[model samples]
Structure formats: C-alpha cells, structure tokens
Target: MSRRQSELEGRLDDMLSRIAMETQEIKELEQQLTDGQILANEVLQRDLEGIISGLQEYLRGLRDQARRSQQQVDSLQAENQSLQLHLEDSQRHCRQLEDRARTHTQDMSVQQEELSVLRTEAHALRDRQVESSRQQEELEVELQQLREELARQVTLGQLERGALLAAVDKEKQSTEIRECQLQATIDTLQDEKSSLQQITLRLQAQLDQTRTQYTETRDHLDQTRLQLDRFTAAMLDPQEVQSGPDDLDEDKYRYHYYNFIFQQDLAPAQTARSTKTWFDVHAITVLDWPANSPDLNPTENLWGILKRKMRGTRPNNKEELTASIKEIWASITPRQCHVASRQ
Candidate 1:
C-alpha cells in the first residue's frame, strides 16, 4: 500500500507539473498569435502546428490516464473495502486532471479560431495588393498617353507659329511696298497739281482781258447809237424858224430878216454846247401844232407809202419781211414826197 501510494503521488505531481507547463505554453501562444502572422515564415507556422498537435496529444494521453485511474478506483472498491478511501482520493485527483485537460482543449480551440481569423485577414491583404497593382498599371498607361498627346500638341503649335511668323513677314513686306508706291503717287500728283495751277492762272488772265475788251466795245457801240439818235432827231425837226419881213411878198425870193420856225416834237429838249447847233433854250409853241404831223413830214409820207404796200402782205419770216420792206421803199414815187412837203 505505501509503495502504491508513493507511486500515485509521483504520478499526480508529474501531471500537475505537465499541466502548469501546458498553461504557460498556451499563454505564450496567445500573446504571439496577433503579431506573429504578419512576419511569420512557413518554418514558424510548422513549429506552431507541431506544438499544438503535441499539446492535443498530451491532453489525449491525460484523458486516457484519467479513465484508467477511474477504472482502478472502481476495481479497488469492488475488490477491497479497506482500499476504498485511497482509491477515492486517486479518483478525485484523476477528475481534476480531466478537468484540466478539458480546460486545455478549450484554450486550444480559442487559439485555432484566432489563427483562422488571422489567415482570412492575410488573404484580404493579398487581394488588395493585387488590385492596387492593377490600378497602378492602368494609371501608368493613361499618364503615358497624356504625355504623347501633349508632345503632339506642342509640335503642332510650333508649326502653326512658324507659319504665322512667315505670313506676318510677308504682310510687312507688302505693306512697305504699297507705302512706297503711295508716296510716289502722292509726289506725282503734287507735281501735276502745280502744273494745273499755272494753267488756271493763265486762263484767269485771259478771262480778265476778254472782259475788258467787251466793256470797251460795248461803250463804243453805245456812243455810236447816241450819235445816230441825235442825227435822226436833227434831220426830222428844224432847229430854227425862218420868216421874212412882216409883210413879205409871196412872190419875192429875198427878205430883210428871215425867221426860222422849228417843229415842236423833234426839237432837242436838253441844252447842247456845240458851235454848229447853238440855239436858245426857249420852247416851241405846242398849242398851235397838230397832234400828228404825218401829212406834213416827207419821211412820214414815205413810211406811210411803204407800210400801205406791205400791210396786206404777211411775211412768214424775218428775211421775207426785210425783203418786202426793201421792195416797198424802192417803189416809192417822187409825187408822194412832193405831196407830203407843205408850208
């Protein structure tokens, strides 16, 4: 009995020691589980799996030992009533070991759940890395295309600028040429303007001379017309009255003092200063004269004869009228002039 008791004590002590070691290992694993998955290599994963499997195996062995101890307690109770107390103590110790084994199993299960969650998170990280890599490739392609398009735009702009510069140069040359031509034209036109001014000055001088000549000619014609009017008046009217003595004989041809009688109508109304036509300013007697002297005047009688002949004949134009006047004046008889002259 002492030997068996000593052996039982030794076994309990060893199981307790093993259980404490297993708990310490589980606490270490729990602490390492969260951070270990990020940098853990395949070798570390293998070592962890070996450790977990070994703990599971150790727990299984503990359960089997507990079941064997229960069997021993049951057999001892049936075979020896005196060993029942000792066997009961051994059974209690076995139950405690079984409870410890169950606790270890529960702790192992929790650690496995934590490892599984860590693996899922690692898979999610790998998927994000692949998606990010694909996005980076797409961005690089878009950036390359934009750079090429920008290069093409820059080249096209350079070509257009060159063309515009060339066009500007051509326009500048054309403008300079046109300006020179316009300046030459202006100078030529100024010369022509000076020539025209000289010609206009000559024409103005000619026009002034013509106006002067026309004024002199018009004055000469006016003087000639005045002389003709004076001659006609002098011929139609006697300037003086000639009368013989108071009782002068009709048959006598000579008289002592002769008086000249003038006609009233053809007498000069204004004063005249001339040697040959000197006369008094006394007016002629108008009350004793006839209203018309057409019968007494020879020139009046000639005009009557001419007008009588031409009155019946209507001349169509000025030339015909002038010809008719010439014919009537030539046909005048000497008897008509003698009949018109009376005392």
Candidate 2:
C-alpha cells in the first residue's frame, strides 16, 4: 500500500513539471507576438505620416498656383482697361485730326476760288490795255498824215506872202505841241504795261506755290488712309500675326508668343534658341500633341475650328473670310472654354 502511494506522488510531480515547462513556452510566444504587433504599429504610423506630408505638399502647390493665377488675371484685367483707354484716346486724336483736315480742305477751296477770281480780273485788265494800245497807234498814224499835208501846202507857196508865212508859223507851232503830247502819252502807256506785267508774274508765282502745297496735303491724306486700313485689318484678324516659337524659323526661335489664359500669362524669359524681334501682344493658348505641353500659338485647334465655322461652305475671299470670322467668334460656348481651361 505504501509503494502504491509513492508511485502516485511521482506521477503527480511529473505532471506538474510538464505543466510548468508548457507555461514558460507559452509566455515566450506571447512576448514575441507583442513585439511583432508593436513593430507593425510603428511602421503603419510612419507610412501614414509620409502620405499626409505628401498630400500637404501637393495642396500647398495647388494653392500657390491658384494665387499666381489670380494675380495674372488681375494683371490682365488691368491691361485690358489700359488698352481700352488707349484706344479711346487714339480715337479722339483721330477725330481731331480729321476735323483739322476738313477745315484745311475747306480753306484750300476758298483760296482756290479767290485765286480764280483774281486771275479772271487780271486777264480782263490785260485785254482792255491791249485795246487802248491799238487805238493810240491809230491816232498817231492820223496825226502823221496831217503833218505831211501841211508841209506840202507850205512848199507850194501859192498864196499871198504875208498870209503864207503866218500859216507856216501857225502850222509849225501846232505840230511841235502835238509831238510833245504824243510822246507823253507813249511814256504813260509804257509804264502801265510794265506794271501789269509785274502783277501777272507775282500772281503766277503764288498760284504755283498754292498748287504745290495742295499736292503735298493730298499725299499725306493718302498715306493716312493706308495706315488706317492696315490697323483695321490687324484688329480684325489678330491670329494672322500670332505664331508659336516652334513654328518660327531657326533664326527667330528666341521669341515667344505672349499667352493670355483665363487666369494666367506665359512667355519666354530669355533666348534659348535664336534671336529676332517679335510682335509685342498677347496670344491664345494651345496644346502640343506629342509633348503634352501648353503653349501660345495663334493658328491652333481652337482658331481652326472658329475659322472652319466661319468658312461654312463659302468660297474664301476677303469679304467672306471677314464675315465668317465674326460669326464664328460670336458662337463660341462658355462651357467648351471651361473644359479647355482644365486641360
């Protein structure tokens, strides 16, 4: 019986020892699992922090871009106002010039009329002087014939001596007085003719000077008309002068078009390709196909669409082109422009 009791105690001790070993193994596994979970949590926290930081940076960039866009839009609006003011000023100046030109033309017409009247008066005066000269010549010829007849009567000596001598003296005295008067008349007519000739010469010089001035004024008016025509054409078709840097020739690649986007502006800061003088004006934005970059180009997809609509089955000509462009520009939808702005 005592041996049976000892064997049972030994079995209970072995069972207790096995239970203690199993408990130690289980504690070690629990510690390892806890460490693994801590490491996982740390890694997850770090990843989450990195993602948030990236998102913040991205949002900051977007805000900065938006601010810059707003600034550009403000600048554009200011520029537009300035342009409108300048246009109004130019128009006012043009109107003043036109008024001045009209006044000058009217003055010229008045002067021309006065000159014509003066010329007619001088011509009539000249004709009257010519007639006076012819009449004086006839009177002089008749006086000469009378003097010859008197001399022939004196040579014949057919009357009484005292009577003939008296007649001869009387005739001599009369002839001398008539000759003196005729010479005075001739001197007076010569002076009048010289004065008329001088007046005619002065008038001719004045007429030539006026004609030259009129010619110069006409030429200036023609030049002004040409300039106005060119200005109008440029305003009507701004795209004709808008070109991209890539489309420019190699020697002119340094220049870039100034783009006026909805809320932004873009242009080259320095020459990277070539050197050439470029137009100073704003341009519309366009997208490059392969490069996927936005740029300013006058002749692009949007413009092309507008042009196509303008053409609208009509033959191309100056009149048709102008009319079509006006119509197409008026038809552009705002929603379509909004989508383009996103791109």
Candidate 3:
C-alpha cells in the first residue's frame, strides 16, 4: 500500500508541471497579440498625421487664390468708374455742340432773308437812276435846240435893224414913228433874252445837284454791302456772334423821308409872307391850307388821283363827298405810296 501511494504522488507532480508549462505558453501568445496591436495603432496614427498635413497645404493654396481674385475685382471696379466719368463728359460736350450749331443755323436764315430784301431795294434804285439819266439826256437835247433857235433869232434881228436904217433915210416923217416902234421891239427882245439866261442857269444848277446826290447814294450802297459781308464772316465763330439792333420798319422809313423832304426842300420856301402871297394869288378865302392838309404838300400826290376819279361823279352833300374820298383813299395800296415817293 505504501508503494502505490508514492506512485500516485509522482504522477500528480508531473501533471502539475505540465499545466504550469501550458499556462506560460498561453501567456506568451497573449503578449505576442498585444505587441502586434500596438504596432498597428502607431502605423495608423502616422498615416492620419500625413493626411492632415496635405489638407492644411490645400487650404493655404485656396486662400492665396481667393486673395488674388479679390485684388483683380478691386482694379476692375476702379477702371469701370473712370470709364463712366469719361462717358458723361462726352455727352455734355455733344449737347453743347448741338446748341451752337442750332443757333448758327437760325442766324444764317435771318441774314439770308435780310440780304434778299437789300438786293430788291438795290434793283429798284438802279431802275430809278436809269430813268433819271434818260430824262437828263432829253433835257440836254432840248437845251441844244433852244440855243440854235436863239442864234437864228439874233441873225434875223441884225438884218431887220439894217433894213430899218435904210428905210429911215428914204422917209424922214414916217421914219420917226417907225424908229420908235423898232426901239420898243428891241427892248422886249432884251427882256426875253435875260429871262432865258436865268432859266438856263437854274437848269445847270439842278443838274449839278442831281449828280452829287447820285454819287452819294452809290457810296452808301457799297458801304452797306461791306458791312453785310463782315457780319456773315463773323457768324462762323460762335464766340464772335452777337445780337444787333433791328432794321427800321417801312412806316418809320417813310416818316423819316417825309421829315427830310419838309426840312430840306419845303421849309426854305415856307415863309409867312410867301404863304400869304400864294393864297392871295390863288384867290383863296382862307389865309392858308388847314394844318396837315394834303394841299401843296410835296409828299401828297393822291389828290390829283382823287380828282380824276371824282370827275363826272357829283355828290349832293359834303358828307357824301367825304365818304367817297375816304373810300378811295382806303383803296390806295402801299405800292402806290412807293410810286408816289419815287416820283
């Protein structure tokens, strides 16, 4: 029984030893697994760090591109502002030029109208001058004929005087009466010669005055044309253009011409005594014409026309006559006034 018990103890000790060895092998396997896990964790941490660094670099590049883009946008905005200002200035200048052009066009139109009127007046004046020249030539021819007639009359008078002297010697008694008659005829011829000489002097003076007036008129026309040309040239420059006083109207011109005729032509002949003498010569009941009456007025030529129209038309009353005269006067046109003034 002792030997059997000892063998059992020995087997137990061997079994226990085998179990310890197995436990140690199991612990080693666990340790090897833990080491592998640690290595894997470290490798994963490094990969994560590399990825984070790549992301940061990409973000920086994006930020730099955005900054460059912002600067470009600012520069473009400044250029756009400058371009807008230039466009505004261009528009303003264009408007000013248009205004100036419109003004110049209107001025040209007015000046052209005025020039046409002046040309018409010039043509009328030339026609009048030509008529005056023709009348003057006719007067000169009449004067030459009168001078030739005067020479023939002088020769006849000389021959008659010689015949009268021979007849006086033949009959003394009849000669006395005949000589007295011949002397009276000689005195009448002398008075006629003096009157003709006075008339010739007056005609010569009138001719000289007419020549002077024509020369002055031609000079005035030339000066007026020069002024118009200068004004037209000035119109080209906007800065030089200016408004001037308007020309006188036709009524104002007529008034001035009438005043001139009164002052230069009528005033000298209108003394109180001369006016009285004229009325006395006409056997007029009134001392003179009524104030502003057409009678004896140089500018009034309508009276003769009225007289001619009234011929054979006898009115029963003064009122009817006045009405007829007023109607006829109203019918007279501006053209008639111009014709009367020219005459």
Winning model by TM-score? 1
TM-score head-to-head 1 vs 3, winner: 1
For all predictions, the C-alpha RMSD in Å is 54.0, 49.5, 45.1
Report the C-alpha lDDT of model 1 over 254-323, residue by residue, as the tens digit: 2112334644343335322441143332223222355455456578678777877888889999999999
Clashes of each: 9, 0, 0
TM-score each candidate: 0.28, 0.22, 0.23
Write one digit per residue (lDDT tens) for candidate 3, span 95-178: 999999999999999999999999999999999999999999999999999999999999999999999988877788687889
Q: Could you tell me which 10 consecutive residues in candidate 1 have the lowest summed lDDT?
A: 248-257
Residue pairs with backbone overlap in model 2 = none
For candidate 2, lDDT tens digit of each residue in 1-343? 3354456556655755665575566556556777777577557556755765675566566556656666877899999999999999999999999999999999999999999999999999999999989999998999999999988887666556778789999999999999999999999999999999999999999999999999999999977765554444445455643653223232222123223433222334322223112232323233323334553343354675575565555746888767767777777776655545455
Q: Which pairs of residues have clashing backbones in candidate 1?
A: 240-260, 240-261, 241-259, 241-260, 241-261, 242-259, 242-260, 242-261, 243-259
For model 1, the superposed segments whose C-alpha errors exceed 4 Å read 1-151, 240-343
